[model samples]
Target chain A: MNYSNFKIPAVAVALGASLGGLVYGYVNEAISLALEAATPYVEQGFEVREDNWSGEVEPGKPLLVKHQLFRGNEYWFWAGTSWPGATIKVDIFDSEGNSVGLESFARDSFAGVRALPQKTATYLIRVVAEYSKTGEGLTDEERGANDPVEGVGEFSGSLDWGLVYGYR
Target chain B: MVMIENVIRIFGRAPLAGLGAVFVATLIFGAGLLNAENAPNAPERIDLSNFPGEMVEKVVVPIPAEIFAVLEKLDEPDWNSGIELPEQGDPVGERAILALTFGSLVGEGFIAVQAKNADEIQTIGKRVLALSEALGLAAAVRPHSLSIIEAAGNSDWKKVRDELDATQQTVRTTMEKLRDDELSGLVSLGGWLRGTNVVTSFISNSFSEDKAELLNQPGLIEHFRGLLDSMKGPSANSPQIRSISTGLARLEAIIAPSTEISEEDINQLRDISRTMLEEYYFEKKAAETGTSIN
Candidate 1:
């Protein structure tokens, strides 16, 4: 019941959490740069005329935005995270709640999907990213083992991420 | 809770044991968080099953160029009708009008590009410069306007179009970053009105099922309605915004929850859009000129 003994360890725990937050901020900046890298490829021939709309999404939690996409125009959506070793999944859906999407993958912290609408109507875009240290994809045998990496340099960190899209 | 209370009582009997236990617990918690911060321990795959995504209130509607691209690909519509230059008159400026004017000017630039009128593009580039100056956003918009002028000089229509696009973007972006959400919304509304005015005009003239179907823009109308609904302070309560909201509602009622639109409906919506554009963009009296700004 001595309060004095709990002091040092509590301080250390509090300090550890603060330090984790600081590191997360820096890692987030790196992830932002990774997201920007995907921009040039998605925007090569397009003239974007609207504000970039983005929002945060956690791992396994998909985010959806409904947009009025006209038929006969090519539109692209890119989702990214600052969290390293995280893979993003994006799905485009119809009003009937049918999945009508195929995602484009880049090995970095971003994923995208480009679709030319068959009907000029509002479509829902769903984006999700998952955090895994070896998100680079696992081998059949690696899947069988609990720990895939024999020796790893660092532990994976996962954080919130966002999305941006445009039309030419 | 009872077990933890009992443990605390036991720790009271042995202070040294309590200290060791506290230290060990802290270390374990720290390590777990570090494991969270560290690499290998984070889960690698994302399971999207049962994932429920939340809605983002802010919506960026597709710009005029989106429809322009489709028109160009399907049929090369004449740019002359859509390309009429905006008149610069009655030069007593106000902030709200400037905000709306900035958007309309950019919309005019899009029309000029579609026409491939370099002179008109340069004219609009100048108009945009003046509006930005009036709004004190010249620093952000000046470079894009300059680029637009120079690009037009080289007859680089594509580059000119891009610069015009960039000019509007820079202005809108700076306004948003400065927390001038009202100005940003008006700017969007101005652009939307002008763009739709011309689009409906073009579609009306063409009058095909394919062209008319493009007016099935229920999403965009709702986006604008939502934008108007979310407006705060002056921008939200502006008479211009109120009228635009009323006009948008009229348009939305015709478009929403409907797979088809008749020529009459297109003309009616176009009339509403053009009338609203005249009042807001040109400051014209509704009866004096309900036509789209020229």
Candidate 2:
């Protein structure tokens, strides 16, 4: 048995398999982080509904989901991504394309928006994930000399995003 | 020596194959990178500036509690006046009928909670259990049913409401997991129809603009109609579904065009909802006794 010839190709196959597993693991982590972002609202007496949405989006490209929100109940929609230093945005819109979100905040890797709908109609929620080149919170030395940080920088590609919502 | 030579020849071919594996691996990794960099056909950006309100991947229907919460603000109507329970008897055998009955019962449970009618809530809880058993979801629903009874016993209206919501959600989720999506939609549809009937009846009594606005749910109507349209096999062709579908279309025609529902609109909706319940949903046992659900 000439086992020596199999060494190089076997290593390449193993490497590819590892990369695939890493991508899957990263996406799952993003989903968990997205749910974690809603903990603050949950503490504020918001009942997080079980229904949620998740998908991959290109950096700077926005994803939209439509939901029927009752007029009286207050709602909070939160989104998160696994990409480090990624800027995320979550907002709600009415049928007329008007911004109906009352309060919103976006930080690295996560964002949230609050909405108290004026009518019980199908409203759109827009979520955006963008790559941050300067790695906003990082120090200059951490930014690396020529390239961006490991997960930041010119690697502007699709990012996995998770969205969860709570109502009070 | 011949075996060694043959092994070397195989090794000579291994470099190309090794390169191919690495190339394939790099391609997989690069695809993820390239997709992020330049997502083909991906819209450059989505903003209110050019947002067409299209592309809706999911729609979450507002639970019955959400509307009940609003109705509470408009001056609590006599929720007891709206407490209409179907006759208690053997569980309906058909899954569709049982699903609708379960939904309507949950809706009634909400009203009972609002009315603070402990007895009615308890009865509704038992009926919910019966219907759930008929639908083969007794295990999942029993706990919620028991919770509803306990909450009603203590008069903890909020807990009762939560349990009711949980009950319907559990049924819908369980049905969906069983791939009975049509039944799941029916459960929601059943609850919505019952809720609407109560709301319209209450609004018609008071006839306030604010109260009437609560019935202005064209989106939900469309959603239920879509559910009906998506049904297949016996569930879709059932007389009850067909009747409700027609009734929903009529409701949609009236509600979709109006930003504000007139008193006339309220009466029409109330009548339509009541008729559907009496004819298709609530009157099953009543027909045998020469009585009505109310």
Candidate 3:
């Protein structure tokens, strides 16, 4: 196996192979570093809906009040009924806790309403529903029962509208 | 004496043979190692004619300014004239919200579609279709609903009220599903992470000042040019470079103007990606071999 004769070529091959590997590793590391350096700031997180329950609404039964929120400039709101057949009235408020306007709708007949503001901002909004045609306050018993509306309903767990400003 | 001489002759010839063998072997080994290191890791510039992902991001990323402008056009109220159907209320303003609803869903849809293991995307898609159908129906029945409100002579604009109520129901249902689905949260996170990619960052930063202006720059073309350069560069074999290039190439084709991304582009990308992988594997093998030898 006289290795002495094959020394030159063996060493050359080994050298070439090693150098190629080293170069490759270095380039990979460089590119990886570049990618790391260029990683953009990804603003991804739970779109925290800002709460603006600042103003007070007229405490009336079936009272329709429009609450303004400086939120959802890029998104819309749809109406949802707790029961299959229900009539719901939603009142929106502003940060000052004042009734801005009122929006009324039927649950089963239609989908929901969306409001697009001139600008983006936060607002204090609430929804209350009643079966009565008169805008009167709900009785304690009625309030205790399965209320289908958001703020004025028996089920208040899902009523809190966390309206986010941006489409996150 | 004869056997000894033959042994000496063989030994004498061994060095030259070894040298030739080493040269050939080294060249082969070096070529293989370089190929392993340099093979394409990314997709090539695709022909846009058959691209399926062109509007993928468009359907996902919300361009607020564009949407707002559209809304304003739809809802611009004429002070002198009375409020007409589309112009009377804020249906146009509503357009902004609509666009986002669809855009965000589309973005999430891509992630859902890509999920390693999850049917959440399908659920979301169903919700989207439902919402879309609901909106279409509402749009058609809106006039009828308004008539119901007006004929009753309800003062508080009951017509408007009823329509809004309907809209609220649909919006609530859609948003609820979006929030409730476990995958929604995950999708958001994934989107955020994807946006953090180097290519994304570069474009975001580049277009920060005026996005519209930036879009006008034909990013796809520029990206293609850069990609071609990267492919020809000395480090073209690097997997990292190849992957980055691949990402860019795919994105460029997706954003390009040829309508659909062509099959050619996808094939090229796949080929490049495969080559890059091969190069990486072989280079790694060579390194392991070298390490073991010394």
Best by TM-score: 1
Off by over 4 Å in 3: A1-76, A82-85, A91-111, A120-125, A132-168, B1-184, B192-294
Docking class of 3: incorrect
lDDT of 1 by residue, A117-155 (tens): 767888877666676544347544334432436654233
Query: Where is the poorest 10-residue window by lDDT in model 2 chain A?
Result: A1-10
Please list the residue runs of candidate 2 whose C-alpha ends up more than 4 Å from where it truly belongs after superposition.
Answer: A1-47, A54-60, A80-87, A130-168, B1-54, B284-294
Quick one: best DockQ, which candidate?
A: 1
* DockQ of predicted model 3: 0.01
Name the regions of candidate 1 deviating beyond 4 angstroms: A1-50, A134-160, A166-168, B1-51, B90-93, B283-294
Interface RMSD of each: 16.6, 16.7, 27.9
Candidate 2: give the clashing pairs.
Answer: A157-B36, A158-B36
- State the C-alpha lDDT per candidate: 0.63, 0.69, 0.28
Q: Assess each model's interface with DockQ, reporting 2 decimals per model.
A: 0.16, 0.11, 0.01
lDDT of 1 at A159: 43
- Give the B-chain TM-score of model 3: 0.20
True contact recovery of candidate 3: 0.00
Q: Tell me the deviation in Å of residue B174 in model 1.
A: 1.5
Q: Per-residue alpha-carbon lDDT of model 3 for B1-294, expressed as tens digits?
A: 433332222223366654664466346434423312221111223223443221111011222222222222223212112100011112222322332233334333333222211244334434444434543434433333343334233333222222322323333333434443222222222222221221122222222211112222123334333533534334445454455346545545543542432344333333332332222111223322111100
